[model samples]
Target chain A: MSGVAVRAGLFEQTDAGVTLLGDRCRTCDAHQFPRAGICTLCGAPDPVPVQLAATGTLWAWTWVTAPPPGYDGPVPYGFGVVELPEGLRVITRLVLDPDVAPTVGQPMRAVLDTVGTDPESGHDLVSWAFSPLDASVGL
Target chain B: MTTSEVVVAGVGIHPFGRFGDRTATDLGVVAARAALAEAGVTAREQIGITFCGTAYGGVASGHRVMSALARSGGPIVDVEAGCASGAAALMLAASAIRSGQHETVLVLGLEKMPAGVIRSSFFAPWQEQAGLTPAPAYFALRAQRLMATAQLTTRDLATVVVKNRANGVANPDAMFRTAVTVDEVLASRLICPPLHLFMLCSPNAGAAAVVLRRARPDDAGAGSVRLRAAALRSHLPGDVLGEATPLSGLAVDDIPAASTLAATAAYEEAGLGPDDLDLVECQDTDAARELLAYEELGLCGPGECGRLLRDGTTAPNGALPVNVSGGLLSKGEPLGASALGQVVELVRQLRGEAGARQVDGARVALAHTVGRGANASVTILTR
Candidate 1:
């Protein structure tokens, strides 16, 4: 597990709730994540910002005990495919109860998965993780 | 109907598995050499373009492979559409050849998943500290949402494993050649809630290639298959919203819409309907996606996919005869190569090269592949 030190994106510190983010093509009205310069839909290029919805339904997902390379983290993580209300489906690490197994169409809300920051680069990579909307974690 | 003719002259595949012996470059070179050799083309002089496919190998990976092979120094580009990388390369190669850019082009798919826990954008330093890292959680969230919205059951997904495993049993080249029973699949260790280990495709390593050009009677041999269409529809950013109407303002992020969008594009581009297809190679890295694929590819009525699977509609000899080559579930996911490898199998089957697992008289075939990025590629092939 990566140790915690301050000085990251700090986006997770805010309680704005995880809203799936994307760019809506100013020219063609298309939305996507990671913000692409090329408008993949109509090839118009230059997609402006259009914040996606916070709530979405779960599609299908798989548990990746083994992550991809360069990912230094815990084992047995829950990676989910979320169908945002925006029509964009996303894959993210989820914040769900361990006993809870979400089906095809369960309601979920987004939460910022705060990956600890690198004391070096300072580009705190934050994850937008989804939580089962029905149940709240007991703090 | 578009009459642009492009056929798969040859396809080469290296077995998918961890090879401590060689690097990804070696794997790619082997597949490329195999493809060139199979086409019986002595020189790369005839090839005008190359689209080398890889996701996690190295920077300028394609250039390195081509330069190492000493093949076509012609314009070469690398494609990284996540899981659809190979098919994306295939699409680029096909377009180049059909547009008269090159007489023959090679599409190579290769990957060497470095030994480690694969951390992606899903979980990085921030996600890990927040208790997020595994990819299955991302997919699980999707499954959870689907079950609630679609009114489906976990057993509905078991059919995917059942069908694919049965299909895989006959494939010697399959990574997991053993056929699995529903009970066995159901009993396997759970990766995500309701999703079993048997339902998941492992991270594998391998390389696959296909060389495309104008149809040559002597080359695809008397029986080789022709590439009718290679369609790639990248998801439009995050939501891939479900658009019900221009005015309703209700966007549903249903899997079928995305899949239908891609599959429809491919079928239309090829001028063939679902009925004209003899087989389907939909992505089933996990089981739930397989059911979604059934609807996305128009193989059955929505909500009736579970019924279709129960009734054997998607079995090897069933109405659509889907995934006869053992989907990613049984085949193991060397993500980069798996997509084009789907094409390789279809090309082999259409050309009477699939051997025992060959669908009796399959003249038309379709291959669809997807990744965590939700990128999709569907290619239609005919003999």
Candidate 2:
């Protein structure tokens, strides 16, 4: 199945896999997600677009039962901070079942999946999330 | 004068709860009028400036409030700094008085939030789309981390709720006056993992107002309370792993949070330390966040909050007696009025007017708040 990203410039999906897009400052060696025009760490005026590691480790996780406004996803979903090998962390929905309890320091690999569907257009709203590398945890 | 002494001449509040028919303007007017009357200034013309803090009240909120009171003669400013809006506004009013820019200033905080979960727009659109926008999600995440590091359990979190609710029973102005047991808190529906429904505050409606003036000669002998320090701080770069952060967070550790920075500045400016505080009213948006605040405000050592809770070090009769007003947990957070509501409680404690919840011989008190924008404010008041 094919679907578009929920937001632009966050990540790209291709035949190979999904790679998170980010900005790295050449002058200061700063890293940020969502491609910043300037380096947030060093105030450098120039930043180069860089692809982040697709796999990371789950540092912390939570089950969000109460949804926010405009949320069109299943209730009681799991979301957490995934720490990439590069050291920066990105908050993403953990591709896990609501009843599944995630442990800290678990290996996680980013996967492009459907977060919700636009009711009018009937198009799946896809975003990147981290799934347990272990098949048992993924279930 | 580089350090002019500022005093809180008066304070007022419209009870925090669902006032379905009343608008933010009405609440603000009522509180402002009571504050003005308490200051012995019957005429609003005596107020040289006014600052109104609100998150939802739209443009010219201060102007609308001033016009309602027929006090539109002076400069009126509307300030928004997330949940610290009221404290920020009070800080501004105190600064104007300290700088000799105005003799008398009125600070008002008003809010009328929508029912149910508070949907904040502070996160990026993508983050929101990923279902990370509900306020409690971040709180639960933080709580989970704290539980790991501080060796706290769900029972400890529930105990915090029970303590605060018990304190709330004595506060006439608090929204939830009924107390809850630990079992009840634990049984409450889970909004976010590690955070039960009763453990978190509701986004409700209310308003708080205070009148500030330069300390006069007679203030020395009177019962008036002086504002020793009103300090505000914003989030620093690389400190993004906590509440209200967007998609990305820094890898670095040991970066001080906004609350610590604000508290340090406030303590320095007030010539006091955590040990000197007679009582406190830190933001208890959730049960665990209050534990984090104990460390951030220098009330206890890091990772020592669990012990503090077990020993009742922050209970009404404990060493610190934090949030004796029942806090946002009991008051149902009206973002704008939240911080100033803390001040009103501090005033009551200091003046010995807090009938049942009063801490014995309270002289120095601190009110702390933190919210979106990573804004943190700590206001120290002394009698």
Candidate 3:
């Protein structure tokens, strides 16, 4: 079944795969995910939009057993921090098999996956997540 | 800032636990009145101003508390910085006294939180929907990194819970006063990888208050605790990986954590270093956080926190005890009251009044707290 992106302007579905949308400071070259109007580092106004890297290394990972308020996601979901080559670390969900445990420094590729269901709309909510590059199967 | 001395004339608390039907104002009034009585301030008009810290407390929280105490008509400001709310209020109150704006000020911290996991508005709606707002995931992720880099083990984490829970047994105001074994802590339900239910602190109700006044030359031998330093700092731009950062950053390791910045500023302001401290009360929202704080506060070198616990260096009877009031792990965190509760504990220890949990010869003590919005605060007290 297909799903809708949880939030618009955060990622794009291109022919190549899911690519994150971010903003890079024109003055200091600092990159930020989820986009920003101004550079957080140099305070340069009007940072330009850029496509973040599609693959990165897992910096950290955890299995969240309890769901947060207003979150209609499945319990025991995997969460992680992925460090991209552009020096930006993105907090994303991990698409992993039930038996597979994630390790740091593992290669990860961005993918759009269902994170939860919208309580009001009853529609599956999709968000950008990281999957192990070596995995032959997808969640 | 002027060189005027600001002293803590009195401190009070409303105990840390769930209080059914008791409003935040009720807790705040009880604590405030106790502090005022201890300070011998019968004339309500003598209070120059009031600063109240709260995160969950609604609009005009301080005004409601002041009105209940019949201490209205004075300037009452409410401050909020997540868990560092109380420290932020205390910092402003001390500054007012030092700047000669107010000769005497009352600082109060109170909270009445809902049950279960802490819910914060720090994250955007999308992030919350993505299952990122409960906060334990962030702490567990941090712990994962610490284990890989700092050689911290799950055993070490359990040991921290054991130590703090044992210490809580001696504290009457603490919520959880029973001690648990390391094995028991590890066997508890795993909320997240590397963290168990016992390793985390509960969000509950409580309040703490302090009376700060300009010190006089004649007050030398009256056993007053002087506020040597109250430094609050925010996260640097690239400190997304730090303790309080809710979202992404430049992910650079060069930027110092908020705790480090606050601790450095406080050490400089107080003209003291880690060696001069006799006791410490630091943020222990989770077991791993306390270990990280030891490094951030310069209490030990990097990669040495696990050793600090294994060697019993931070035990209650050890030199330079930490969290003798059982810490948030035992006392339960009320956000607003957490930092000031630490201050109240320090005052008791400095005055040789911390019953069974007293640290012998605690002349210089420090209280540190860091929380959401990437804010950190460090307060140093000397008798």
Candidate 4:
């Protein structure tokens, strides 16, 4: 379950679980994923980094049948918006059961998994993704 | 500065479709020349400035087009706002004319998009690798939400394609001329759940241009189309899931979308409402987006778009005929040329030149486009 992260500064894997790295505004309490130096809502500089909630509700979902440019992942993979408890809706890759269609309001939990392979380095690319909480043990 | 009424002196377009050998400058020059000819503007000094709208066109795209025409002395600025690029340029041109800064200004929109599904550089390399780019998946995700909350069904989505493609049959400039049935559209390949192949628009090459000038007293009697109102707005903060932000937004925030903001401002500026519009050309990047536009533009109430379509209110012969020029769904979205192309179609219809797709007694029209960066533009024109 260990590999090179697709990108740095996005998420961290600990013995406890996978948590996304984000920033929270000290002034207005706004949250941003992939962590920003300044708060977009209040324009407050130097927002502090924080770990986002591990679980969220599915806001929307879809299956990408065709691969986008530079995407070396499996075709027809699940993708969706997950609204975390902190009020941030994060767009992420979805790990789903083949026969189950995703529905709004379903509970999803974050996981670090292989999303694709880097075309240049030929290494398995790992990134933060979400999976149905009740469906399976792991992606 | 004394403000003046601005009029669309002329409009021209290069047909929308795939053009393998043609460059963006070539497409832009042809449209610009036609617009100049139609406006009776022969001398280069007659044009005070030039604005070009393009997303894919490279550096100095406007300069390149103007140089090609040998009319390069004036200020040639290029504008980009994703799919709203043309509308943004037109907004600037109209403002210049209204402020009396220039007697005449030329606006050109052109694009030579790369083949296959659009690969915008808007996303970071990691985002592209993660498959979060604004492509079919993002569109499908939005459509999925609409279906859940707006009473939109997969069948309703098919009906939009059916209506627009049928309308495209009448527009020679449209990329898709053949009418498709709901059955055929539904039977097409499913790019995503709830969205079929026909539901999406093709990104291709095309160009459209407009000539704006301060209206003279004689123009009142000449059936000239006046630029009644032109408004552009960007996405407000806190809708993490809204089109504005690429990755995040506050889920509970209730800010209005860019389309609503732009439409509201345009309606106020023109002293008109949705009831005043006789026809409309809205962005139909996907079938569901057109329906979403219905609510966003105030044509119908929220969660009421499905009923409006089922009741045939947006049809060719309906009370408010929309996309009579086939929209991006049929004409194919060249990004930069899209909104200006809609303007060209509206001008033709107002002049009684839209032979097959004419809405009877059409007098007022609106063109709406929204795209990446969450930019939205709404333009109202009157005969």
Candidate 5:
């Protein structure tokens, strides 16, 4: 599956499991989260891609009892705000338990999960997710 | 700032309990009738505009209800901005009144949250897929942050519930009047870590409506509460992923960005300072959040809200009464209706109608409401 040409939406996947391929702003040098077509900080065209780590520490986490409205994801899933070493905090499902009690200062590893698919277009949408890594299950 | 005058010509609230005799629409019609009667208006036919705010049901939901009331055809609009939807619609009505667009406007909020634990697929696709629901999650995240940085404990937060529920007990309008203990709050089923089921708002079905118009000749002389300042803003530009990045180390204070924008705009509009506010309707989706709002809204110095709670400063008879409406925590959040209900309660307090839990001489009140996408609104009322 490594070279499966996984119909990515033109964003680069980090070896650390972060799927957002982003560019660095030449002006501000700020690293963007989701891959950008241009430097969001400077409006500079064609920002470059920088590989990121697939794991981060759990800054905070919680159980999403009810998703907002009209989200078709599985119920009772755990979600957390993971803090990547690169300095971005992003939200993604913690695919471990319905009761993933993500405390402060926990270790988290990133992965790609299927978000949804459009039947008419037949394209699969994938997004980033994180899981707490057990000490016995180190990444 | 020059102000456009308006009055709460009438008010209505359906009872807050699980009675399956009627649907959300039935609940809405009931409140609508009560409002028209209280306003001394014959029908929606006299009203030039209609605004309904709800998040739980159908599209064109408000319009359908307007038609049900048999008073359609002016300009029926739908407003949904998380829990602040009702307040947002009221902002629109106030705007219309000031501009002389319409004299009498009916603004109502209705919602019927499915029974029991509020779970399931009701989120933005990215958010739902990522797993950050509403209320408890945000509150838990804020609580965790407070625990990490503010040196607050679950016990301090529990007092918010104890006080608000006690406040709810006095108001027959509140849903859960049975007061609970901090130990009870601590022992309840954990929704997220320190947050327990008791510490959070209940999911209930209810509708609250308000009728507004230009004040009558004698109405301004007595028994009328006037609108002061109404300010609403979404969270200022910032990445809100509660710590998915290296920057998660920064506290809301350190950022000095999101809440600052909202507080500045709110205070500026009211032409008042935090010192001027006698009572507040701060968001308390959970106990932790109630404390955070104290800091964020400048009621206390950052990181000292726990001190305020533990010392009984935010209690019912405290210096500044907070959430005399039992807040979202004790009263439960019905999405669209919850925030506006906060406004209604503030109007009651400023009008000296809040019977038992009434602030002794509440001359000014603030109602802070938030919606999805980090939007925030603050409304101030004075007697």
Candidate 6:
């Protein structure tokens, strides 16, 4: 079953798994996530859109117990910077149990999960997260 | 480099606490008047220009503050640089004095934050929608990494809270003047893992002001404290770990953080090293942040903060006294007013007027602040 992504142009679902999306500068080979109108590295006005790696390593992680405004996720959730093999880091949720902790340098794979159900539309608001490659995934 | 000297003649502050009924103008005008009164400078005649720093005061904040005091007809500029708004204003005023452009300028930092967790809009819409936008989450991420790499623990972090809370006891201007224990700090509700609720600063209301002037040769008996240097810097290109940076950070590590760059420039401008500092009032938005600041401000070697806190090196009477005003941890963060509050404390300490919180024989002091928009500022004062 397909659900609406929390934000467009961030990731795409495929048979293999979910892959993060970004833009790559052809002139300087710089990569930016969520794409950019202008390349931050080479000053190019337009860059090529590309899919990011499905697997990465957890660089740093934190558990946010207090939710900020505009958030609809569960309380006391985990999120962190996941370093892709191509040397780019993206901030995304670490989809794990509330009690489980993520270790730095641990392998993680992008996955699609339902963040919450829209109150008005009654549709699942899907979001991307990083799940541990070695452990059983739960959300 | 013989730079022209700019001195802080006087400072005034509206006690940092929740003022639900007061507006930013009321606090700003009161503090401005007190500073001008203490400086023996009339607002309309002696002051040449005014700079008001505020993040949420809206437009014409300077004009509103001036009009409230029945003083005007001079240029008053409003500035906003997140939490470092006051430091940015101080730097501009000092530069004007150093350039010989203006002799006397009044700088005011004021804020009246909305009650609740600060709903910062620094992150993208997607990040905020996904619950990745809380301020403590970022602090905790850094704390976790620093603990892993620097050999720090939750206990070490708790010690910083304990020290700052105890320091608050002597500061009447602080919102939390009661001392707390390490156990209480560690046992407090965790806003984020490794960061307790008590370890974080609330978004509160307050105001602080300083009067700066070019010193004269015959001003020997004056209450002026020399503004040795006021330096402001922004984050280098690849500062991924910075609070203001985008969620997707560059994986590069060669670029320095804004605080380090600002501190280096301040030391060079002041011609004084960290060893010469009698006391410091660096940013302590959280307990772990104070440890990060120790390294960024060149107070200690990297990875040595754990040992430093355990040995009481930064206590009130330790080798280096930091945050004698209880820091934002106890004062709560008033955003625009936070850095100026640090300046007020430093001025009091350098002038030997800090009472029970005084660092013995403190003749030189430093005030540092780092804020969103990747801004960092360091101001050094000497007596």
lDDT score at residue B218, model 4, on the 0-100 scale: 82
TM-score for all models, in order of appearance: 0.78, 0.97, 0.97, 0.97, 0.84, 0.95
Residue-wise lDDT of candidate 6 within B1-383, one digit each (tens)? 13377778889999989987899999998899899888888648677889899999999998999998847588899989888999999999998888888889999999999866777667677667777677777788888878987899898888898999999999999999999998999889978788898888888999999999888775454355898888988875545578556657677755677899999999999999999998889888888899999988988888887777888789998988889899998999899899999999999988889999989888889999997788899999988
Instruction: Candidate 2: list runs displaced more than 4 Å.
Output: A119-121, A136-139, B1-3, B124-126
Which runs of model 4 end up more than 4 angstroms from their true locations?
A118-122, A137-139, B1-3
TM-score-better candidate, 4 vs 5: 4
1 or 6, which is superior by lDDT? Answer: 6
How would you class the docking of model 4? medium
Candidate achieving higher TM-score, 1 or 3 = 3
Could you give the interface RMSD of candidate 3 in angstroms? 1.4
lDDT score, residue B148, model 1?
57
Query: B-chain TM-score, every candidate?
Result: 0.89, 0.97, 0.97, 0.97, 0.90, 0.96
Per residue, candidate 2 scores C-alpha lDDT tens digits across B204-255 of 9999999999888778854879999999998777655554476777777677
Per-residue lDDT over B1-383 for candidate 5, one digit per residue giving the tens place of the 0 to 100 score: 22367777777887665557677788777777777788788865788787887777568767767767765578878788666777777888878887988888888888888865555333434444333445466667768878777788788878888898888887777788888998988898887766888888777777888888866666665567766665656643234532112112222235643344566776887688789989999878778777878887898887788888888777888899899888877678777777678877887787788888789888888888654555566777776
Query: Comparing 2 and 3 by DockQ, which wins?
Result: 3
Model 6: residues >4 Å from true position, as ranges? Answer: A41-46, A117-122, B1-3, B220-223
- Which residue pairs show collisions in model 2? none
Decide which is better by TM-score, 1 or 4: 4
Model 1: how far residue B199 lies from native, Å: 0.9
Docking class of 5: acceptable
Lowest-sum lDDT 10-residue window in model 6 chain B: B236-245
For residue A28, model 3's alpha carbon misses the true position, in angstroms, by 1.8
